[model samples]
Target: MKQPNKEIRVLATVTDYTRFFGLPAPAHPLLTLIDLSLCRHLPRVLTPVVQQLYTVSLKRDLKGLMHYGHQSYDFSEGLLVFVGPGQVFAVSESLDTSNVSGWMLVFHPDLLLKYPLGKKIASYGFFSYELHESLHLSAKEESVLDSLLLSMKGEYEQPIDAFSQDVLISQLEVLLNYANRFYHRQFLTRRTAEHDLLSRFETLLAAYFTQDEGPSLPTVQFFADALHVSPAYLSDMLRTLTGQNTQQHIHQRLIEKAKQLLLTTNLSINETAFRLGFEYPQYFTRLFKSKTGVTPAAFRVSAN
Candidate 1:
């Protein structure tokens, strides 16, 4: 008997993605803006797909979960989600494609080539955020983003010319900038949640050092996993609220622990370093000096 070959399809281009969505070919080879409302029908559910293009989508009035990063998000309101290349995502089986509204902007990485935005794109951390951490846009924010999407659509719909790519790219940059601004605004406006998360992170970090088991040094991923948030989301939230990212926070906590061991314990420098999770005493000395402007021995001498 012939066995069926089961392999997940990887959509490697905008055309491949559009074909899967039952849409016409894109106006440009490298970019496309899809208006979901125009699609008269969609699959009841979509299988998980790994795509090789960046996707930014604003979904509204959709009923079901969108899974990404081992989590699922219900798209019951105006929500913005960004999926970078090579990420796997799927629509829930209960998805109601009818009454779907909003737009999907997908672009190939090659489209960004030779542009400054290409190099700077990685700094937009929201792209790596988890599904549940999607940006819930206010009505005003939705309108602002919708207008930008429409502008991009209009620019690209015109016949391709020398100015078309540049115009579209400029609009895309503006869209990203606005998203960045709105993410910062979200962090500021959600004060109660932000404070709660910050408290939880601090408690987790403290407990990690106090615990006797596990790795000697804690990683940013440790706190991120403890908080049920993506590393990028955790770092972005901390950066927005505290002017420090996750690794910086971890280092600050580590240094605090090191200082305590150095001053309060009767351990030698090597012992102190080992207790603080450093394999190399010289590395610990280097870091301690860099952070405190004094070597561990010098610090202990001053403290004594």
Candidate 2:
């Protein structure tokens, strides 16, 4: 029997994007910013979905829904969506191609290493949010972002110097901070939607830790799939409401379970570990020590 050759999907690198749109290669291979106004849309040429480097797109005059995973959402209201590397994205026909405006900032993770932004970026939560969880901006807010985009464009066009990278990085940070603020405001102001999300989030978290039916702990995607939301959306919403993301929320619940076990049982560390879905007792011990600064046995002894 002859085996068929698998087709390799085209992944867009920085250079590929430049060539695709008739723009120059980026000064830094790891990151680039493109002014939407300078480019023309060729919707027919684009793939239904593409795997590429991370892209942060801020757009105006966009209509129709943006699909992230299984969800469909409106982008007509100046929305912001963060697509991580390798995530699939489907581009629809622009409702008014002539009116397309805004900036697209694309960066590889390598661009942020040895910097504080790299370390703290994961803490921001929005990167993990789903497409429908996109931030909707007001006209005034859009103006503020446009101003920052203009400043960034200035940096990109200038000569490369000792200060160029630093300047651009600072601008990127500023933009992200403003986004953080806007997201917080969105969480606070959109009470009906936010509250509904918050309620659903609590229910989902409770179901996971309840341990009533499952033999093992749920993977992040398990809950995400159940909620019809992305893991990032769940994490971001929890962070907004409870000062914790999904992973942290899971850890907290695990700790609570461990506390109850220590107080009520004569089970050994291994026994408790197995009961809590840990495949290895040592793995369980390490997590317990990391969270509580005490090993399971030590905690049991202290409690006794």
Candidate 3:
């Protein structure tokens, strides 16, 4: 029996994406601002799609499921969701488009050409976050973003001028900066939940290290997956709380375990490396020296 193809679709260009939803072609080849309210006739997407574009979108009173990453969110309040190039998006159920409010700013990488945002945009960690971890906006926060978007839209409607790209890019940078600020605020205000996730992360770290068998080395992705957050989201949250990212925390734990083995166990340094899940002993030795100012052998010698 022939099974249907489940391969994800790719909407390679902004025009293709706009056309797929029966919208007018974009004014610029590389960028577009879409009002979600106009998308009342969106077609069902039988397969998931990956778009090679960057999008910063706001949604309000949206109905039904729009899947991004592994989690689902109820967008009853104003919220922002970002999607970078090559992220998959799926609409599992039809949206009640009549009540959908907000705009989506999408642009190709080329649109950022010769601008600082082209490079600096990579630093915006929220772009890599999952939808369920979206930024919930208060009314005041939403107003600030809306005013900025209005400026961007005014520029977008103007005919192509030498300063059009420059104006657009400037407004975009401001929008992104404000979103960054708001995300930081979100982290601080949601202290209870953030700390809970932190505690869960620590517990998972301890359990992984204390495994009697198969003590596989942990990666940031592993911890993020275990904690049900994106890798970027997990690291950002940890940094906000502890001033150290996930990798640093993992290394701290690993080093503590190394010290414990050196002091209490009869295992050779080589054996210690393997037991700690290091595939190569020299790498472990180098890491120990870097973190603790001594190689594993020297540490064991000095401690005794």
Candidate 4:
């Protein structure tokens, strides 16, 4: 049987999630805004788990690690993070759930179709960012995000109209745009930290291919685990700090290694493929050409 796609299981619907947290049902079947203030505290300890839909969470006055996609993020201050479907996440019960305050906006993908955001949403890379890599809202930024959330809640509470979905979705798109800008700001402001991550990233990539038990291996999870972070977090941090993501970074390094072997050594394309862990030479050729605009052998000949 074919393997299932990688996604977190949010087995609960909007109503289920809300009701579990002690809130009323969602106004719509596909979307809802949860006010943490309205719900009674989760008095019992809970295990971490992942959800199945799109979640745009705005948290405030909370401290805890939200474990998602193999990494635990220390949540401090007001922040936002998006979790795509199928990514496993656990909320650490280290802090009192009663102390947690904020709004959690959960919406299924179905809620987004028929809108421009549905098509352009994939371009929003912040959606893939890890919890540690969550967006930190400045006092002013928090207010802006808060206002948007309130508007959404207000819309839901109003009697349903044809204009309601359009208006709410529009607000969501606007909120996302602002988030994009803020992420760029985060990239700029967190230069030192980003640079550190970049350095570690480089070392990690180099070691993957260099050690005897080295380059022939290491899955995304292995690298993430070794780095003490989540794959999504590492990738998100790279995207925020650099223009590329973790997967792209890996491919870049792989291509560079192939280029070196092609030009510096007499390794045939097939030899290079096996050395680089490609079971098929044609696959390597295709990936190489896609990234560099030339076949591996062609590049090797040109270098000669």
Candidate 5:
């Protein structure tokens, strides 16, 4: 058996990843589709490492946890996980791959150059989601994605031509769009959990503002860290469920508090802003106006 490397292996290219997985050379330098079943020497574990390229994988019947950041996800179903460039994650030591079957599609960032997909790729927030937040695809969704991956692989294995890049890029966009749709489905199907998370977020925000003393403002990262999720994942979830991202949610909460203080308390606008954790009263005034269509003082006067 091949022993796992002690140090993190930074896979910089598709070829590097293929070699590490004990597979043959990639047919294309910039892109490749790996059938996980073809690998004979599967490692029992991998140390935390960063892959400096995009990777989208679908795994099934794996008996181990995939760790990303501080969370671990069970890889025992037909789930899809995405890792953008510079993501650090690891596989569990007790990896049981006896029934493992999946496909990994890896493409270098350079391959996206000169394409519209390159500009919009970052909008696919799943690439930065935690492992536990991976997409759990239904059978029909899995079939749709599987076909797209196979199509991309077919193009990847063919002889390179002038139109090869365009065809491959187009296929990739389709795959991403379908993944986006499936993620929305997942969010809607898991409504209970999402709603629970939103409640926790609201409670946390309330506590932060109610505290008598602390930093002037709570950051999006603060909430994400408290909830044990990435900021991108938290924002994306809020956007899908509440029609707003984390920052917007925070602002909305802040405005509600500000309005209450303005109407019920004798504190001046500056005092109210300070109580709501704003360091600058003017900044608070601008934000209040933007969110409520009136300056803080104007609102306070109108209320009185």
Candidate 6:
């Protein structure tokens, strides 16, 4: 018989994950920490998949691209990456598990269901789809994360007690919080590259405004795609250095163009709004007033 297609596998429960990787069952029903070296073979996961569990992994010697929504991270550096529920990625055919050296901590969404981490978990921006870049950790930083992992591992091995869940949850939350802080540090430390991105962003916005055609309003995703960064990452980088996210930057540029048109041209309020690519004149009026503290008409009159 011809070989069947390598289908997408949904690793929903803690057991599902270990079984896929040929490991023994986990200590808990909802969580597991797997040593990659223990895997005798790798699963064929050439297509994208959104797992039901959250995985935070630090591994080296990966032989294939990790796809996040069609984009791939080379993983030449920054071995740490977080994948939350509904985020898509796939291990390619070239994936190397023979010499894999790292630990993966996975937990079902239900693990956090009753704890405060459950509510706070969704708020983590790094876990969002748009922020798919892996975090590069310094030696000290790696040690900090590893220590927390060890704590989780210790609690995981112990007999079930009331404190087991509580201790594990606390350690996991701290781990996530540290990762967040390190991501912020990564954003600031790479000032030169980020500055180039900023320049490109400004140039892109300028070109968009100057062009006489394409009347649709500019969106955050539009600029994000042009810059080749995730929407959340782009916003975080911008906010860190410039104090405003992508939407704010777009709005600021829009107001500048509106001011220029109101003073430099003879277009009516409606025409000016349309020229600036606003679908509705009322929205233009509202946004203009919010930014300028006066309506378009009032601004034009006050200018003269």
Cα deviation of 242, candidate 6, in Å = 1.0
Q: On TM-score, who's better, 2 or 3?
A: 3
Per-model CA lDDT versus the true structure: 0.86, 0.73, 0.86, 0.74, 0.85, 0.81
Estimate the TM-score for candidate 5: 0.91
Weakest lDDT window of 10 consecutive positions for candidate 4: 1-10
| lDDT of candidate 5 over 115-178, digit per residue (tens) | 9899899999999887788898998999999889888988988999999989999999999999
For residue 289, model 5's alpha carbon misses the true position, in angstroms, by 1.5
* Candidates, ranked, TM-score: 1, 3, 5, 6, 4, 2
lDDT of 4 by residue, 1-304 (tens): 2222344335457775666555678888888888866543545324444556788887766665555555556666777877776667665656445566788888888778888788898877666665677787788888888898888788889988889888888888888888888877887788898788779878988877774321453466767777766676677667777778787888888888788778777767888888888877899899999999999978888888
Q: Which candidate gets the maximum TM-score versus the true structure?
A: 1
Please, what are the lDDT tens digits per residue for candidate 6 over residues 179-213? 88998898889889889999999999998988665
Off by over 4 Å in 2: 1-9, 22-32, 40-43, 48-51, 64-74, 93-96, 108-120, 212-214, 258-269, 285-304
Name the regions of candidate 6 deviating beyond 4 angstroms. Answer: 1-6, 40-48, 71-78, 129-132
lDDT of 6 at 130: 50
For model 1, name the residue pairs that clash.
Answer: none
Estimate the TM-score for candidate 2.
0.78
lDDT of model 6, residue 221: 90
**Minimal lDDT window, size 10, model 3:** 1-10
lDDT of 1 by residue, 1-304 (tens): 2211233569999999999877879999999999988763765435578899999999888876666645677888878988898888776666677888899999999999988999999999988888778897999999999999988988989999988888998999999999999999999999999989999998998887885432477788878988999899999999999999999998888889889888888989888888878788899899889999999999999999
C-alpha TM-score for every candidate: 0.93, 0.78, 0.92, 0.80, 0.91, 0.87
Superposition TM-score, candidate 4 onto the true structure? 0.80
Residue by residue across 1-304, what tens digits does model 2's lDDT show? 2211223245568767666556657877767888776664534223444556677888777665444444455666667777776675544443344666778888877677767887878767777677777788888887898899889888888888888878878888999999899988888788788788778766876776767332475566776777777787777776777788778877888888877887897778888888888888899899999999999999888988
Q: Give candidate 5 regions above 4 Å deviation.
A: 1-6, 42-45
Stretches off by above 4 angstroms in model 3 are 1-7, 41-47, 69-72
